[model samples]
Target chain A: MSRSALGLAGSLGTTLQRELQLAFSSPGRIVNPLMFFVIAVSMFPLGGRMSAEVLGTIAAGVIWVTALLAVMLSMESLFRSDFDDGSLEQLLLSPQPLYFHLQVKVLAHWLVTGLPLVVISPLLGLLLHLPEAGYGPLMLGLLLGTPALSMIAAIGTALTVGLARSGLLLAVLVLPLSIPVLVFGAGLVDTALNGLPLTGVVAVLAALLVLAGTLAPLAIGAALRISVH
Target chain B: MLTVANLGCERDERVLFDHLSFSVANGMLLQIQGANGSGKTTLLRILAGLNSDYTGEVLWRGQNCRQTRQEYQQALFYLGHAPAINRTLTPLQNLRWFCGLQGFSDDAAIHAALQQLGLAGYADIPCHQMSAGQQRRVSLARLSLSAAPLWIMDEPFTALDKQGVAELEARVDAHVTSGGAVILTTHHALQTRHLLTVVNLDALRTESA
Candidate 1:
């Protein structure tokens, strides 16, 4: 590509690297959400006196809900520091489209936080006595579904990033948007365990991801500009 | 060139400034003068197209800035009131990321700019360890590295000592001499012996009132 194009790619790559660096440098940024996901998932068994069969019945829903909440827990931090330090102004002033850079940020967030939840879902599945067949579908659903959660949560994060107490508002704004992903993801495991063809629900989850990927950046970019103002 | 036609802003039902108009041509400096909370930073942000809650037009190169945001932003650099430095990152790392966001990257140029800002040995050290003025230098280092023609800085002189302030004034003078334009807000009396236009917001506030 030409010089400017190369610069755009380099900028995205550098942003992704910085996101990872920040997340790792402050271990709490990554660890807190992961712990929340694991602890929240593990709590279902403790709180309920259900047998393995009944637990298996609710495992998919529990895991999916916990993952959604874990992702939400990490959302407020997405743009908070950037907004506080005036880097959001720098990003807005950048020649590159804010859409592209914002997406890179969301993608990196998913990779750091959401991907870990997906990677460890099978172990969580075992703890919840999720059926053997449910593990594959659970991991698959999370892998395909969580990007949309991150992208949707990004818009809410951007909107509330300027607020001093944004956690409740973020959940209020984002949780509704995430319901479809939760439904499709949690249902995917049930379909797989019953030996039903999973393409329909899988396609729905994939479509949600694609739609979020395409449209969220626009909302995110607008929200960021408003927040900066 | 940058032009504003009857620009105005209000915050929390209070009029900050109204019917503000000014222009800065190539090789000129416009200083926004006002006391604290007189909306100097708000005016600069409106000019930089960061704040949209304004009435009237901000024309960059004879076109509405919002209409051609990409081209407009490409030629514009904005430094806000707060120094936009990440405390966890080293000065070098911060510059590298800033340059990358500006759609370029060069380690040598970043280091040289840091050195010019008197941050020679603090390149690898995290910003939290540096003094407030040292961290401010890291933010100001971008001015030396950036080639954007229009520099909009809000309180660029903050946290700098006397010598550092003088050095920054010289740099701004050089920038104007090289056919670049600047709009900035400062409490310090700038030593720029050039085509300087002062937009006293305090006077404008009374006029609008």
Candidate 2:
């Protein structure tokens, strides 16, 4: 492989490994998000009297919000360690294009944090009494949407990297931008639960992912320049 | 090998610098001296192709560096005030990543470069566990690993101890000896027996502007 291509691979590999190590080292990191997922799902039972009708209606919203929060919780780490230790500056200096490296970092973030959320989401789905039919579309929607979340989250991570106590700022910056992912992802599952064709919702989610995929790297790249400066 | 003509830059409604023009050919070193807020870093960024908000042109071998960014980047390595080493990764892993990014795939070359930097013993240790000087060494080790002709370093000597400083000076001298060009900013006077030119930004700002 070309040297630049190999560098890209190595960068992505190290990013993935480091993110996973950070996630695993802090039990609170995993438990907090898992708890939020469960609590959000469990609220459907308590708030709605455990009725199948109410549970069925709210399950999608509960799961989407939980998933969004879970992803947001981890997004701060995307650039924090690099910024704190001056690696981000080095990265900016690299002969390789920053956009390509940012894309790799975003992908690694999705794999380490967002991928696991997708995997365990079915358990949360069950907590809300979401039917088995909801599983495929819910998982699929997250599979498509969570990466979009990470890519967009990178913009926030870059913007807030130099700021003090940036975790809250990261959420504030990313949550509004993340609305489309939540909308289409939940819309996919909701349509599935309602016995409607899910193709349209899935298509929308896919389009959202593609759009985010295309534009977010540039935004994040710009944000990194500004933040570092 | 590197030249800037009529270079101008401004940030946040304040003019950082303007109409700056200079050139450094092969085996030469240019030191950019400036106060904390004097756009030294910004100028370095423009030369490195990271910041484009500037007027005029930077040329590498008579071609506009901005126009041929990838080519320019391929021929240069910029070490900023930040070390850029991934703390979680071992020094070897960090160098490996940088080598890959710079388009060097030979494992032997990477190991030899690390060994040359006196990091052979700490190659397997994570950067976070290494001392500050060690982390700095990991970043500086790139000087040997990369064959890029131009080096733009921003305050590279900031955190180094006396020994680290001496090691860096030796590397700088060796790099220039090998016909590489160096452009960097440092508060301390660098004693290198070469065609070293000083561009004092404080003087240039008032005189040139």
Please give the RMSD to the true structure for each candidate, in Å. 1.8, 3.1
Which one wins on DockQ?
Answer: 1
Off by over 4 Å in 1: A1-5
Model 2 agreement with the true structure over B13-113: per-residue lDDT tens digits: 88888889999888888899899999899899888877778999999889998677778778888887778887777877677666656654555766777
**Residue B20 error for model 1, in Å?**
1.5
Report the poorest 10 consecutive residues by lDDT, candidate 2 chain B. B98-107
What TM-score would each prediction reach against the true structure?
A: 0.97, 0.88
| Chain B TM, per prediction | 0.97, 0.94
Candidate 1 lDDT over A24-62, as tens digits, reads 777888788899999988988899699999999999999
